[model samples]
Target chain A: MRAVVWIAEGSWQACVDQARAILPPDTAVTLLHVAPGDVEALAEGARRGLFGRHPPPPPPHGSIREISDAEAGRLLATARERLGRECETMARRGRVEREVIAACAQADADVLVLARDGERKLGPPSLGHHPRFVVDHAPCTVVLAWAQAPPAVETIPPPPRHRP
Target chain B: MSEVVALLALALALAASVARVRFAPDWAVAVAGALVLLAVGAIGLTGVGHALTRFGPTVGFLAALLVLGDGCRRAGLFDALASVMASFSHGSARRLLAIVFAVAAATTAVLSLDATVVLLTPIVFATASRLQLGSRAPMYACTHLANTASLLLPVSNLTNLLAFQAARLPFARFAALMALPWLTGLAIEWLVLRLAFRAELDVAAPQDAQADADAERRPLPRFALALLALTLAGFVASSTLGVAPVWVAVIAAAAITIGVRPRPAELVAAAQPAFLAFVLALAVIVAAAGAHGLSSAVDALLPHGDGLLALLAVAGVAAALANLANNLPATLIILPLVSASGPGPVLAMLVGVNIGPNLTYVGSLATLLWRRIVHAHDETVDIAEFTRLGALTVLPALVACTAAVWLATQVT
Candidate 1:
């Protein structure tokens, strides 16, 4: 099986581990992390400048982008260890919804696994703006993983392959 | 009755500001509120004009600082400072904690808290990864110092600038009064971080002298430093000459821009007109609240004495309110109430709002930004652990700093 699993800053490990158990032993997986040049961070940069007589210079282009890529690399490394295989990792900077869809098309995977409700660091499930976009517009079968603890591997269903 | 209606509008505006609604950004809500006030005759065009005339220069000074800070960042000044900080680690995590605290404090005081968050944080993490030290200690130091150290200078934090402008205190007067409080806050923060992260910092480290040497080899930011120095000196001089600090900040920002040659779009993007609009709108809301009895409510809460106990009480009230609505709005609401009581309460309120945010991520905009940066580094900050650490650290710092400021007020 060929699968593309989307990950974010605060996703659950169960989402990865459970999906791995259901896939064929030799399945090829692609881990995609898209860091949309966070608007919140940029607004913060602007807020700092708000007090000054002159406008602040734009956040050094790629300052947050570089940080995002490095963080994505670290996250992918962890996912790779759990999957017990070498999976392709792709990190891009742009709108999250657009990038996720583009990546799905480019990877041409049989299915895409994602946390249906966005994973927040320490809060209840945050049904973020991105998940709805991913679900509504994905290029392939979409698996909406929940944040619950890992279910028994035997009870897990086979990876769905309903391409949109 | 108009005041009552205005208060309701303001409350709705603030609620929408922080809510995660998809309709618009927080600034838009603020703008809408201000417009509503004008439309309802709660505050007239004359009142809006008055707010602008009063806050206009401070707003201009703030914009200029953002420009200079951004230009310096682009010039690689902050990175150079970070590399220099990492070099002092000497391969020991304990020593690195000391150096990180110092660097973070200086950056927050000079470049502003936002700069420390957006600029220096990544450097601290990168330095940790290179040294193979646990990143948690440094990360906490960065966020903690960003708030506490900002007590020192008007340029250090937005709240300080707002209060300074409101009080119309001299630049020197502001610094002199805050010096003790700032030092006390830093000391408490440092000690707390050390105790909380002792287990993490106790690890032995192999020195990476070669990386330090290479980092040191990069070109120095001599021009940026000169500009910064000149800017600080200009602020002092402007105050003495009775010139607004905005002039100094604008000239310095312009000079840096000339040298850095950043695109105009980059400059405008960093200006954050939305936030400026928010500030203006918030001022209008608070003004309307004053008409409705909010100021009298605050006045009634004021302690009668100028003694240490009174200072502490005022600080406590400000802190509580700050945590409720985030420091920026809280400061805006409280500023009008406290303005008539004199500089002592105003400065004390500044201490409260500034240090108060250390208690929770929602207490200040800087803290919220810190959380975002932490996640970008692939680290999770459990809210419970954060609150636990904060309870141990922030409460003490708040008390010590407020007391120090009160003492300074007495002596000076």
Candidate 2:
């Protein structure tokens, strides 16, 4: 079986750990990391807001894109180390959800693994908007893992009282 | 009647574009509004020329300052400064917060708020993260001070540039007049930020051997520092020399760019023709609007004198307008009416527009940009939390700064 595991910031460890524990030992896994383009967009927005169409000189340290790419690589490397297996690693950029979906399709995987990245309480929001979209729209079987220990059932708020 | 309707429609469209349009640049939206006005004959070519002539120096100075700021960033000025700030922090979140306040305030005062927002914010965020300090206190300090600390100099904000031109105050005199209000605003901002982010500020800094080594190796950008000092001196001397400060800014910007040896693209971006064009177009649109009934409406609502109550009222109105419209357009709309009243009301209005944007996301373009930079660094600013902080800080800063301006006017 082919599996694609989505590795996102903060939640990659959970997804990778779950993949290791659950997936068959022989499953072909591709660890996918998407560097959200919003960072570059934000940097560009600042440039445009101040200078208009003109692009500022590259920063002495590194450009935002470079830093973001390096960060994505570092995250994927760390995840790979924790997974303790030989697997293909992929780094893509753009919208996080869309990129994850595309990586899954391109990998031709039978199952997709990801972690809930938002609210920990029991509800629709437990899967953040991005992960929720990926889970709802992915073209393969979806395995959902929690980024952290699940919250108590009582954490959910009570329903509103009805008016007579 | 048709002309007034067209102008009103144009105003609404411009506001929406500024607030919501993400596909196109702000300068493009503003240019589109200017074209519509011209197409409708709300303003003649001669009137356009006049507006350009009036605002040309402000736009020129803004572009030059942006270029200079960009050069300094390229030379690692802000990075070095952040390193120094981190070193001074000595592994204490509280000390880091204090250092952030001082650095942000001084940066806004000297280099302009755009520099603080666009440049200093990211460095501060990185520094905080590297030191394992809570990023909230230092990050908020950068953004908040970008607005409040801007009161110290004429070149501190684009709005200040407009107000300075209309008020016709000498550079030194302008700084002197705003000095008290500027300091008062920073003090209030510091107090409120400390209270608001007490949990974040109370953390103990972790010992990071790698970060300490990195901070030690970051070299200070002495050339950029000396150039900035020289530029500031030129701004003060220009008033006595009977030359516009824009000349000083241009020379300084050119010097820095040449020293940094930017590529062609960098040079063009530094010139920022699109933003300069936006400013010129905005000038025409504002002038046209002022001519066709908008000014009369604003005039009727304006307080009559420069008394304490009157100055406060004027500032309150300007703040409301700034939040309603963005601060740049708000400055254009309020400036002519306030300028007629004298430097006192103009300066008071400055206090409102500068400080007021802290209240809402829509209050200033700089605040909006600041939000983007924070998000870019993977940090989230909850809207409720932001508004809560803004509500706690803006009014106190506004009232105190406005009163300071009033007192300064009385004394000076």
Candidate 3:
């Protein structure tokens, strides 16, 4: 079965690497990372309580590639290091959802494995917008790779009762 | 004592209906019932003149655009566009999405908001399927962005109409300023959605050059175009010529019914559940206006001037409230209050609240229309989702816009 994996910010490709290690040797895998519009968003994501920053790659082959900053190139290379002989990388230009869906159509891939951390629940997945949109919209069967067990819920103090 | 009892009953009824919606999980039925009650309230109890005045322009514009939009839809304009989009399939999803957002924004800047929803939903649906993609992703982006784009131009949306009429703004000035914020908001909204869907976008196939015959072409009759033009004329006449909007819309709808020979069922299908919400908003806001008197009273208090903070606060409050309430009636309820303030405040409030609807599905007619259409994809957009995602997307943009306008007041 041909499988296409979506690459996201944070540890998406890392999780894909983990999945690649686990998949049958014969199953062909394609890794997809749709770049953010401006590299600055990814670069500045850390302070906003999010992680994973990579500069955009030079435009993909046969596609437009505007020059991005040095940081974007470094991050793209760092993320691209994971693809093995069994997998190929397609660094997409533009928004995430459209890229993934378009790639799925082009590849005619039989299965779509969406690799992400913290979404590996057995029940309905709490996918972020892109994944959720993919789950909601993508045509081929999708297998999402989230965390095996959800992070343990932490208890918080209850609020004080208002004195009316 | 009587006032307290009435208030209690009102609160209880609202509470019960909300609880029922949660319990039954029957959103459509719940909304339908609410719309019925609201419509009855508007037609029977609320003065016809007040309801008509608030929605008159919107109804007129929608009616006109409906004819034009329907004609375009029949003419296969969207389908042809989809064919063009499909031709670019060899490109990355990112490029495709950029095209969609850009087109959606531009089309909505000229076409009405609801028209954008009605027209784009099917094309995106068809395009996604044609592309071997099926997700609520396209639906959400198209719907949300369509509404966002509609607020950019005066000719594009009802909210802009309110601002245009109130500010006495020439179309050129309206476009010059709001256009920047409009693009900014769309880019921000798209970026947020793109971030949400980053992984799903990676795909590779050489998009084919063969145009799907159905996607590229549709047979639209000349009579249909004429009818559409006539309806459009009626809509324009209502707004620009000082005729009643409802009468104009009703006449156009009647003429279409008489002329097109489209299925009566199709007309009802075309006239959607969202219309009920829109009409309900008209009723509820009119009633709410009588009860609260907060915004109007506040506008009465403030002297419209170069007071930057005051203008920003008012604009911010109007935006929040516009999302809190729907934008149409929100615009209506606030119009008088804004007028009382001044031209500068009027323009600011219009831009802020009109665009503000994109923050939540309940915020505008187009978003609400999207809620209905997105359902067909089997993924739903809820109020809570909007509140959460909107914080990252809608709220920040709203802040940026208000700040932009407040700054503009100094120079303009």
True contacts kept of each: 0.02, 0.09, 0.00
Superposed Cα deviation of residue B193, candidate 2 (Å): 1.2
Per-model lDDT: 0.72, 0.78, 0.53
Highest TM-score: which candidate? 2
Candidate 2 C-alpha lDDT tens digits along A1-164? 99999986546778999999999999999999876554454444434333233444455545656655665676677779899999999999777788888999999999999987654446665666678889888999999997667677778798889975
Q: Is 2 or 3 the stronger prediction by DockQ?
A: 2
Error of 3 at B44 (Å): 13
Q: Judged by lDDT against the true structure, how good is candidate 1?
A: 0.72
Runs in model 1 lying further than 4 Å from the true structure:
A1-164, B20-22, B205-217, B364-381
Query: What is the alpha-carbon interface RMSD for each candidate?
Result: 10.4, 7.1, 18.5
lDDT-based ranking, best first? 2, 1, 3
- The estimated TM-scores of all candidates read 0.72, 0.73, 0.55
* DockQ of each model vs. true complex: 0.04, 0.08, 0.03
Tens-digit lDDT string for candidate 2 (B285-343) = 88888888888888888888999999999989898877766677778999999898877
Off by over 4 Å in 3: A1-164, B1-58, B133-137, B166-173, B206-288, B291-307, B361-388, B406-412
